[model samples]
Target: MRAADWSTPRLGLSELPVIEVPNHALAFGWSSKSGPIRRRVDDCPVASRDGPVRRQRARWAEDRRSDDAIATLIVPIEVGIGLRRRPIDDVNAWLDTDVATHLEG
Candidate 1:
């Protein structure tokens, strides 16, 4: 349950200033107590890319993260029960939740 707010990105042709490209950057959100909370985090533009390619991006991104999360979940669970419930690689879930909410609203 961690996240970071990155500065927006600027995209355009050198000469043209009419069209605005949304941010298309990824970022990491971290905290000392909770390690590796999420990844493939998006900047403002990248997040907004959902407008057109939202479903595709989310499907692919979430599948990737779910695979990673499952891999990581194994080690921690095998180690001990204390770490079994810990959250790991949750960016996909976070993204899905956000996108769903946005679409609903």
Candidate 2:
């Protein structure tokens, strides 16, 4: 994760370095201010990003679902991935909805 992308609340405690699990991590116990909590990541997808993920992921997300001749990011901030923590096809829609056109003066 990049500097700007990381914004998780900080937790202070003795921690072990991140290591590859033998098979999979069932759960990790952690002591918090409230109490002890267990972490369960059932469908965590770990990917190796070569470059800036935002621009790349945005384009790739649309391409994966769009069938149109051309796909572009008209309104970058408004349209984005889905609620399920995966890329959604919000970029490539019908021409009318995708972009706004005005007649020349």
Candidate 3:
């Protein structure tokens, strides 16, 4: 994650890393400050060059009874993926929200 000051907290964890997970990583575990958390990811579809990436994780809650176990989707802001230019506030906002959202899932 990029370093930031006390002004903006939402953009503090942006541009963390460009990890390339293996195709076989169906269930992955990572350690956090609290404890270890395991995530089972079914699919990660890249949105069009227009919204954010659709990162979905599997839900293991007891109330989840649907055939699909996918959790809520989180759209992360990612730079250095498309055309490069001066990244002003407007550009960063667009890239984070409206840049890529048309790819076929």
* Cα-based lDDT for every prediction: 0.28, 0.27, 0.29
- TM of each candidate vs. truth: 0.20, 0.17, 0.18
| Arranged by lDDT, best first | 3, 1, 2
lDDT of 3 by residue, 1-105 (tens): 222222133334434223333433223442131111123222322211212332222232211324443222232345445322322344345446532352123
Q: Residue by residue across 5-92, what tens digits does model 1's lDDT show?
A: 1111122113311222334443342222121222323211122121222333445445545654322111112223322222223323
Candidate that beats the other on lDDT, 2 or 3, i.e. the better one? 3
Mark the 10 consecutive residues where model 2 has the least summed lDDT. Answer: 33-42
Clashes of each: 3, 0, 5
- Name the candidate that leads on lDDT: 3
For residue 103, what is the lDDT in candidate 1? 31
Write one digit per residue (lDDT tens) for candidate 2, span 10-65: 21113312322244322333112111111221122111212223443455435633
Clash number for candidate 2: 0
Candidate 2 residue spans exceeding 4 A from truth:
1-53, 68-105
Error of 1 at 21 (Å): 10
